[model samples]
Target: MAYRDQWKMLHLLNTSMRGALKETELIEMGIDCYPDTIQYLKDDGIVEMDGTGVYSLNPMVRRMLNKFMIAMGAGDMKEIYVDVPSCFIVMPFSEEWSDTVFYDFIQPAVIKSKMECVRGDMIPRVGKLSENIVKQIQRTGLVIADISVPNANVFYELGIADAIGRDVFLLYEKNIEQNLPADIQGAHYYAYDRNNIPESVERFAESLIQWKELYRVDVTLKYCRK
Candidate 1:
């Protein structure tokens, strides 16, 4: 794999909207110690690198590594799904039609790490996305949405996610304060002002992780015993 994709994979594993470590960050983190970490992992037959930095993860192998990381004090499972106004850009364009800059940065890591991650962007219509949100909530760990605008898309998805009793996360530009409703104010929200995109995103992701675990435990107990 090329340095760029290898770097992307590492970021996906290590980053959350809580923080992003750029290329320079990795170099400082010891990209020099193993200028060929990807090759080493590959040659050792641990990582499978493909064309132009693209790589396929062997899940069974990854689980073994994850086990080690857990024992060594690696943290909780990290995941974030980007739900949006349009599925216009979900990647693998020819097949899944779900490609976007956001996906580009995040998807590879999620798939490779065997992390629980997903996104909702395909429904171009508000009503459709709303219904789909409920369906997804059934299996999702949490929901993150951007309603920076009084968009029909974000509003309805938020509604459905709440209605289904799934934990809901919200992000909106500081400017949207006037447009959002009183009820929504009670839902967890983070406002990114003037393009401070990464900060708000990270907060929502981390909070969702905590919220999701509680939901999971409570719901599991409710259903399992009944």
Candidate 2:
């Protein structure tokens, strides 16, 4: 497949349920040349096309397409090349605690680990907000979620992160009554306060490094066995 055609085909498949698509749907989506693109992708072994013009990505290729979408959408292609881990910080976006959490804890911890940090606020507001958030989370190597204030948005993003099996680090402020939801109560978290920003940063950095190491090992072993 030509490069652009290949990308278009993959994009349509990734966004579709079960990565399945029909020829009519493709034409309606403005992909006038989708027939040739589907053939190209089929020839390249990236997609399977049936006699009825139904196209689907197998499990493996679907995952790769998802990663490609995230990289393209979030503009984090550098992370793929340099092997620098990226983190997504999920927290309340309001002015009250955003600055303190970002500057005092999240930024320092991420930088100390030589990782790139992305926040919801950093994403351009040009697209669907929830889709943008999901893409950012998909591109990240880690997620640091602050659930101190019981914000619904924070929890929603946290659910997405956890659902995707990303390494998640939970944080909450000290002295707050943390009635963690029942589902996540068993998860370990870091409790911090303004007075201990330095300590919190240090511990967070260490934990991130350790989690990265473990994740690397786990991935390596899985692929090796396969």
Clashes of 2: 0
**1-226 per-residue lDDT for model 2 (tens digits):** 2554465456456555444777766555434575567667777788887788788876788776445434333443211111126778888879597799889888999888777788767887766677677766755666788888888898888877665445577888887745766678435588878777999899888887776564342232111111
Task: Assess the local accuracy of residue 197 in candidate 2 as a C-alpha lDDT between 0 and 100.
Answer: 91
Q: Residue by residue across 1-226, what tens digits does model 1's lDDT show?
A: 2453353334233322322333343333333334465556557665555454444444555555344432212133322122211111112222231233235433432333233556665433444443444445433544556554455655666665565344455655577688866766546776654445345445544554454343232222221211
* Candidate No. with top lDDT: 2
Question: In model 1, where do residues sit more than 4 Å from their true spots?
Answer: 1-115, 123-131, 212-226
Best by TM-score: 2
State residue 91's C-alpha deviation in candidate 2, in Å. 0.3
Stretches of model 2 off by over 4 angstroms after superposition? 1-84, 217-226
Q: What is the TM-score of each candidate against the true structure?
A: 0.40, 0.59
Predictions: Cα RMSD each? 17.4, 13.0
